[model samples]
Every structure is written in structure tokens, then in C-alpha cells.
Target: MSAFLRSRLLWPVVILIGLVALNVAFTDHFLRIQVKDGHLYGSLIDILRFGTPLILVSLGMTLVIATKGIDLSVGSIVAIAGALACVQISDLDDQNSVSGVLIAVGITLVLSLALGAWNGFLVAGVGIQPIIATLILMVSGRGLAQLIADGQIITINSSPYKLIGGGYWLTLPFSIFIVVALVALTAFLTRRLALGMFIEAVGGNAEASRLSGIRSRGVLIVVYTFCALCAGIAGLMISSNVSSADSNYAGLWIELDAILAVVIGGTSLAGGRFSISGTILGALIIQTLTTTIYSIGVPPETTLLFKALVVTIVCLLQSPAFRKRVARKRPRPPVTQTPVPVSDREPVTNR
Candidate 1:
């Protein structure tokens, strides 16, 4: 029980649950869901639906960060992915055609895979710092997306494309299915197949891992590529949900959010062991925080500050160093010893 309480995951879970309960108590509709026209609609559904993108991106990030690398380019990749896909669809003879949608998605994902490999190459092969390397793309990717989109937002009403984000199936959001599948696939690959161990080994000590026969470069490439792929999917959902792609606004600052989720989910920034389950929870908590902020009627300008305050509190609570300092600051209970009465005192014996 003590070990379980001490686990990194415990605090995030507790914070999430506490926030949820508070929301549930304060908002009548927070947990309410209704089915209309065979489609589920409600706050719970929206949370699951809107939170899917974060879940996917953070899952990928868990791997990248676990390998002591960060991809700041994910948000730009998100914009690029959706922009390219929409551009292709708009130019098609039938924008709503499934074939056109499939082609657009496939092309966008292929490009995303290539971009991810580029990041990996710079970091692993060229030895550039991950932040600087990804930042190059992060800045350029938006411009590239704007160029592809002709410096305008691309809007389309393709039903097939809409299904990726706004559609419903099985009386719930279809996006939930995507989230579940990706989560399961990631867990299987990392946990069951032991990919996580290799990542941890690399992150914990890259030279040691290479000496132990682990191919660090290959792992870096795969993880970065995977991160890009996840960002691409998120891009698709974001653009599809709104039926438009805005190079300037689409996925702006999402990479920060994903990194925050990964950190809040119990993954260390220094890199080593990671927890996908914790990342998922972290993503959900972030979405919930957004909802709570809106529900609390905070001003739009103040929302970011409010959210940051909450996040800071949570992060400090989760930080081992912060916790140690707090523990040290707390005064210990004074050790109280009662003096025995003279009659009740035991006789002193000298050997």
C-alpha cells in the first residue's frame, strides 16, 4: 500500500479524480450524456472526443521523451498534415469521395513519416540538440503548410474526412475508437514486446545501451517517426472537426500541451522509464482542466493564467524534489517523553 501510494502515478490519478469530482459536483451537465439520432452527445462524450488528439500525441511523446529526446515540431506537423490532406481533397474532382479522402490521408501520413525521420536524423545522426533540431521544423513547418494551403485556410465538407473527428458510431464518438486502438497498440508494442525497456535503457544511458547491443539510432528514428505519425493523426482530427485547416492557428502550442501531459503523467523530463497509462490520464486531466476553466466562467484572457496556476500546483505536487523540500520544511512532531512518577519509576540498576 505504501509503495502504491508512493508510485509516480498515484498523485496524477488522485488529482484527476479530485478535479472530476469537483466538476461533477459543481456542474449539472458535466457528466450528463444524451443520445439523439443514434448519436451520443454530452460533456462526457466531448471530453473523450476532443481529448483524443492529445492522447495520441502524448502517447508518442512518452516514447520520444523516454529516449531523452523532445519533438517541438509536433504542432507544426499537425498543421502541415491537415493542411496537405485538405489541399488534396479540395483539388479532387469529388472532395467527398472516399477514395480522395483515403489518398489525401495516406499522402499526408507519408509526408509526416518522412518529416519525423528528418528530426530523428538530425538528433541521432547529426547530433544536433533535439530542441534546436525540431525547432527548425517547428518554425518552417507552419510556413510550409501555409505554402501548400496557399496562405489560406482550406475548408472542405467531405463526409469521409469528417468521420475522423465529428462522426459517431456505436452510440459514441468515433474518435474514441481511434484513441483506444492507438493506446492499445502502443501498450502492446512497448510493454508486451519490451520496446519500453530498450527506450529506458537508451534514455538512462545511451552509451551503455549501445555497448549492451541496443541500436540507439534505430530506436531514435522509430520513436521520432512514431511521434510524427501521431501528430499527423491529431492534425487530421483537428482540421476535420472544424472542416478547415488554418496554418496559423491549427495545433498552435499543442506540442507544449503534450509535453505538459507527458510530464504530469509521471514521465521524467530527464528521460528513463515512462508510463503510457499515465500519459493517457494526463491528457484527460488537461482536457478536463480546459472544461473546468470554461465552466468556472473565467475570462478568456485569464484562462491561460488560471490553467497554468493549476498545472503548476499539480506539477509541484508530483515533483519528487519539490516534495522532498516540502517534507523537510514541515516541522516534525516534538518527541514527548513522560517522566515516570517517583513510585512508578523503575529502580536504576548499575552494572
Candidate 2:
């Protein structure tokens, strides 16, 4: 029980539950889920639906961070991917054609893979710092997206494309299924296939992992590539939800959110160990906080401040170093001795 309480994931879970309970306290029907048109409808479902993109991005960020690297370009990749797909779909003669939409998605993803490869090259092949390498793309990739968008938002009119984000399946949001599948796939690859050990080894110590017969450079490249791919998928979901791609704002500051989620999920930014389940919870917490802000009528301008405060609290509570420091500050109980009766005492006889 004590170990469980001390778990890194424990705080995030507690925070998430607290947020849910807070919402339930404020809104009478916050916990209620009703099915209409064969689809679930409720605040909970909405949270899951809206938080899907962040969860996906955070999942990829988890792997990247686990490899002792960061991908600051994910937000830009998201914008670039969405804009490219929207432009493709808009250009199709039959925008409603399923095949055309699929083609567009494929093209966008393929290009995203290429972009991921580019980041991988800069970091692994060129020996550039991960942040600096990804930052270069972070700055330039948005411009590339704007160019694809022709400096305007591109609205797509494809029903099949829309299904990726806003559709329902088995009476649940389809986006939830995507997240589940991706999470499962990631778990299988990392845990079942021992990929996680390699990642951890690389992140724990790259040079040592290399000397120990692991291909550090290849691992770094693969991790970055996978991270970008996740961002690409998130981009698709974000744009499809609204049926349009706003190149400038499609995924603004999402990288920061993703990093926060990853950190909140107990993945160290310094890189080594990571937790997928924790990340999902972190994403949920973030989404729930947003919902809570609106439900409680927090002014728009103060929302960020409110969120930062909550996040800071959570981080501090979860930090082992902080916990130790706090523990050190706590006063210790003084030890007291009782006087022994003369008849029963041996006295201070020295031999």
C-alpha cells in the first residue's frame, strides 16, 4: 500500500480523479453519459474526444524523451501535415471521394515520415543537439506549412476524412479507438518486443549502450521518426475534427502541452524511464482542467495562469526531490526518558 502510494503515477491519477470530482461537484450532470444516435454523448466523452490528439502527441513524446532527446518540431509537423492533407483533399476533383481522401492522408503521412527522417538525420547523422535540430525545423516547418496552405486556412469537405476525428464507432468516439490501438501497439513494441529496454539503455547512457553493442544512432533516428509520425497522426485528427486546417494555429503550443503531459506522466525530461499509462492520465488531466476552467467560469485571460498553478502544484507534489526536501523540513519528535525508581534501578555503578 505504501509503495503504491509512493508510485510516480499515483499523483497524476489522484489529480485526474480530483479534477473529475471537482467537475462533478460543479455540474449536476457532469458524470452522466447518454447515448444518442448510437453514439455516446457527455462531458466525459467530450474530454476523451478532444484530448485524443494530445494523448497521441504525448505518447510519441514519451518515446523521444525516453531516448534522452526531445522533438520541439512536433507542433510544426502537426501544422504542416494538416495543411498538406487539406490542400490535397481540396484539390481533388471529387472532394467527397473516399479513395481521394485516403490518398491525401497517405501522401501527408509519407511526407511526414520524410520530415521525421530529416530530424533524425540532423540529430543522429549530423551530430546536432536534439533541441537545436528540432528547433530548426520548429521554426522553418511552420513556414513550410504556410506555404502549403498558401498562407490561408484550407477547409476540406471529405466525410471519410472527418470520420478520423469526429465520427463515432461502437457507440463511442472513434478517436478513442485510435488512441487505444496506438497505445496497445506502442506497448507491444516497447514491452513485448524489448524495444523499451533498448530505448532506456540508450537514454540512460548512449555511449555505454553503443559499447554494449546497441546501435545508439539508429535508435535515436527511429525514436525521432516515430515521434514525428505520431505528431502527423495528431495533425490529421485535429484538422479533421474541424474539417479545416489553420496552418498558423492548427497545433500552436501543442509541443509544450505534449512535453508537459509527458512530464506529468512521470517521464523524466532528462530521459530514461517512461510510462505510457501515466502519459494518458496526464493528457486526461490537462483536458479535464480545461473543461473545469470553463465549467467554473474562469475568465479566458486567467485560464493559463490557473492551469500553470495547478500544474506546478502537481509537479511539486510528484517530485521525489521536493518530497525529500519537504520531509527534511518537518520537525522531529523529541525523545524523553522516564526516571527509574531507586529501589528498582541499578544506579550509575561503574565497573
Candidate 3:
């Protein structure tokens, strides 16, 4: 039982189960699902809806962390993308026009890609620390967003744009669907192409990986680019949801949240390994914790404190020292031995 509990899969599974149990205990209708306007309605649905964007960002974060890197600019990239998209749409008479929306999306994508490449170049080519390189954008990305929006929120009245963030399909939020599909696609590509192994190798030892013919620089570039793209998608979802883009609020502090999710999901901050499934579970845990707080009528002012405590607890639990202490606290099984006469008889026979 101790061995089983210590398995890599154990903590994540336990946490997931604990969250589910908490929901069931706290909410009268935690798992109760109902059809409303041909769509599902329930707390479970809400969890997925709120969790999608975080999941997306954390997915990219997992990769970056795997390579012993961090992308602080992800949150800023999100703002930039949303700001650009909203600015483009703001020029149109009707924000709902398909052509205008497409153009905005294209522009956002391009800008995000470029920004990602810039970060990659600094980190990979110029050998800048990932944190410092991304910090440059983290500081300026919001300013750029404000500049694009002319220091004002850019409002749009477009259904297509709304659909990206707020629309529904099969009774579930479209954002949730997008997140699920992306997760599946990413998992497949990484696992099928053996990219996971390669990524792990790069993260585990860059110098060794390079000597072994792996293109570490190229890998970093791709990882940064992917992180930016994820941020871009998150921006689109968030901007679309409000029908307006506010650079200030679009993705403020999201980089922190993504990093937390990745860490809580069992990915090491020191890098070298990752778990997509674990990251997803970590996102869910965060969303659920938020929901739990709101549902229980916790004061808004205390929410931050609660979150801080939770994070601290999770981090401590992941520590080897804590695990060792816990192991020491467990009762040891009594040792057993063969009778002395039986042992002597066996020894004589052998001789």
C-alpha cells in the first residue's frame, strides 16, 4: 500500500478524487446535470469552462518548464493578441462581420508568432536567461496592448468573435471544446512522434543533448513559439467572451497562474520531465478550488489568502523531505523469521 501510494500517478489521482469528493460534499447538486435549452448545465460544466484557458497556458508552460525555461511573456502575449484583435475589429462598423474577424485573427496570430520568435531568439540565440528575456515582454506587452487600444477598451459586437469565447456546442462551452481538442492533438503529436522523449532529453541535459545531435536551440525556439501561440488562443477566447478587449485585464497575472498549474501538476520547476495529463488535472484543481471558494461564500478579500495557503501546501507536499517525514511516520510491519531449529536443519542438509 505504501509503495502504491508513492507511485507517480498516486498523488494526482488522489487529489482529483479529493476534489470530486469535496464538490459532492459542499454542493447539494455537485454532479447533478440537467438539460437546459438543449445544453448541459451543472457545476462540472462550469469547471471546464473556467479551466480551459488556464489549461491551454499550462500546456505550453509544461513544455517550457520541461526545458528548464519559463515564459513570463505568455500573459502579455495574451493581452497583445486580444488588443490587436480588438483594435482590428473596432475599426469595423459591425464587429460580427466574418471578414473583419478573420483579419483580426490573422493579425493577432502573426503578431503573436513574431513576439514568440523574439523571445526565443533572445533566450536561445543570445543566451539570455528565460526569465529575464520574457520579463522584457511582460513589462512591455501590456503597454503595447494599451497603445493598440489607444488606452481604452475596444468593444466589438460580433457573434463570430463571441463564439470563440462564449459560444456553445453540444451543450458545452466552445472554449472547453477547443481546449479539449488542443490537448488531445498535443498529446497525440508529442507521444506519437517521440517528441516527448526528445524534449525530456533536451531538458535533462542541454549540452549532452546537443552533443548527441539534438538541436537544442531549435527546440527552445519551437517551445517559445508554441507558448506564444497558446497565449494568443487564450487571448482570443477572453476577448471574445467580453465582446470587448481591455489590455489591463485580458490576462493579467496569468503567467503566474500557468506556472503554478504546471508546478502543481507535478512538473518540476528544475525541469527535465513533464506530464500533460497532470497539467490538465492541475488546472482542474485550481478551477475547482476557485469554484469551491465562491460556492462556500468565502469573502472576496480572503480569496487570495486562501489560494496562497493552498499553493503553499501543495508545494510542501511535493517536497522530498516532506515525503520522507511522512514515510517515517508510518508504522513499520513486524519482521518475521524462520524458527532456529528449522534453519539449522536446512543448513545441515545443504552441507
Candidate 4:
């Protein structure tokens, strides 16, 4: 029981359950799921569906953070990705063609890889600080996306493209499947292979990892690239869902959310260790909170404040130091002197 309580994932799970309970308290059928046209429909399913993109982004962010590095360009990459893919699709003779969509997607992912590689090079090869290196793109990437989008939203009418985000298959959202597959693959690579160890080694201590013959630079490049790829896929989903790409607002501030999710998922921002499951839960928590905000009718002006307060409370709860401090302040059990039998007591001696 103590071990279970001490588990890093405990607080996150508790907070998630608390959020769900809060919803259940105020909203009827919050936990009810029913088959609608052979598709499952409910607030829970909606939370998972709508939160898919954030989950994917946060998943990638997990590895990058695990390496003690931050990628500020993910949101920009998302915007650029959607802008580029939509631009390509809009120019296609058959926008609905599966092959055309595939080509566009391939192009978008490849470009995203290159962008990730560039970030890796800046941080690893150029020896620039991770923040400044990624920030270069963070600040300028939207402008580049705007340029690709011609300073306007690019909308498309493509059924195949729509399937990437809004389509349902086997009575479930396709986005959920994408996230599942990616999460599985990431888990495999990190847990079942040496990749996870290398990332941890590098993040734990770069100099020591290098001394131990781990190529820190290469690992950095790979993680950043992978993170960009995730953002690119999320970009496709975001654009496909709306069938439009708005460069300015497509993925605005998503990086912040991804970072928050990572932190909330039991991953330290200082890096070294990470939990993908925690990240997923964190994303869900945020999504659930968003849903709760609407269901509970939080005033529009104070919604952000409310969200911030809840998140702050959760973070504090998750902090070991904070927990220890609180524990210290708790009143400990009173101590009572044990009564000894007269036979066991020594006789009093007085001089």
C-alpha cells in the first residue's frame, strides 16, 4: 500500500479520477456510453477523440524532454505542416484522391523531418542552447507557414483527408487509432530497445553519456526529429478536422499545452526520466478540464484563471517537496509513555 501510494503515477491518476467525478457530479450521463449509428458516443469518448492531437504532441514532447531538451518549434511545425499539406491538396486536380492525399502527407512528414533535423543540428551540431535554437524557428516558423498559406486560410474538400482527423472506423475515431499505434511504437522503441536508455543516459548527464560512448548529438537529433514528426501528424489532424488551415491559429500555444502535459505526466522539466502513460493521462486531464469548464458553465472571462488554478493545484500535489512540506505540517500522533508493571520497576533509592 505504501509503495502504491508512493508511485509517481498515483497523483495523476487520482487527479484524473477527481476530474471525472467532478463531471459526474454536475453532468448527467457524463459516464454513459451508447452506440450511435454503430459508433460509440459519450463525453468520455469525445474527450479522448478531441484530445488525440494533444496526446500525440505530448508523446513526442516526452522524449524530447527526457533528453533534457525542449522543442519550442513544435507548434510552429504544426502550423507549417497544416499550411503546407492544405496548400498541396488545394492545388491537386483531385483533392479527394487517396494517392494525392498520401503524397501530400508524405511531403508534409518529410518536410517536418527536415525541420526537426534542422533543430537538431542547431542544438547538437551548432552547440546552441536548446531553447534559443528551437526558439529561432518558434518565432519565425509561423511567418513561413503564413507565406506557404498566402496569408489566408487554406480550406479543402477531401473525404480521404478528412478521414485522418474526423473519420470513424470500426466504431472509433481514426485519430485514436493513430495515437494508439504511435504510442505503442514509441513505447516499444523506448522500452524494448536501447533507445530509451540512451535518451535517459544523455538527459541524465550528457558528459557522462558521451564518456560512456553514447552519441548524445545523434540522440538529440533523433528525438527532435521524432518530436517534429509527431507535431506534423498532429498538424495534419488539426487541418483535416476542420478541412482548413489557418496558419496563425492552427496550433497556436500548443507547445505550452504540450509542455504542461509533459510536466503534469510526472516528467521533470529538467529531464532524464519520462512516462508516456503519464503524458497521455495528463492530456486527458487537460481535455477533461476543458470539457468540465463548458459543462459547469465557467464564465468566459475567468475560464483561463480557473484552469490555471486547477492545474496549479494538481502540480503542487504532484511535487514531492510540496507533498513532504504538507506532510511535515500535519499533526503527528501523540506519544504516550508506556506504563510499566510494578514488578518490572526498580526500587527507588534515596541517599
Highest-scoring model, lDDT: 4
TM-score winner among the candidates? 2
List ranges where model 2 is wrong by over 4 Å.
1-3, 328-351
Model 3 CA deviation exceeding 4 Å by range:
1-6, 329-351
Q: Can you write out model 3's per-residue Cα lDDT over 243-343, one digit (the tens) per residue?
A: 88989888988889899888888888887989898888788878888888887777999999988887777777767788888878667899999577765
TM-score for each of the candidates: 0.93, 0.94, 0.90, 0.94
Give the residue spans of candidate 1 off by over 4 A: 1-3, 328-351
Question: Whole-model lDDT, candidate 4?
Answer: 0.94
Mind giving the per-residue lDDT tens digits that candidate 4 earns over 176-215?
A: 9999999999999999999999999999999999999999
lDDT (Cα) of model 3: 0.86
- Candidate 3 is scored at a TM of 0.90
How well does candidate 1 score on lDDT at residue 86?
Answer: 91
Which should have the higher TM-score, number 2 or number 3? Answer: 2
lDDT of 1: 0.92
Residue-level lDDT of model 1, residues 1-351, one tens digit each, is: 999798888989999988888789878877778889998888878888999999988988999999998999999999999999999999988888998899899999999999999999999999999999999999999999999999998989899999998888888888889989988998899899968889999999999999999999999999999999999999999998998999999989999999999999999989999999889989999999998888768899999999899899999999989988878866789999998899998899999
Candidate 4 deviant stretches above 4 angstroms: 329-351
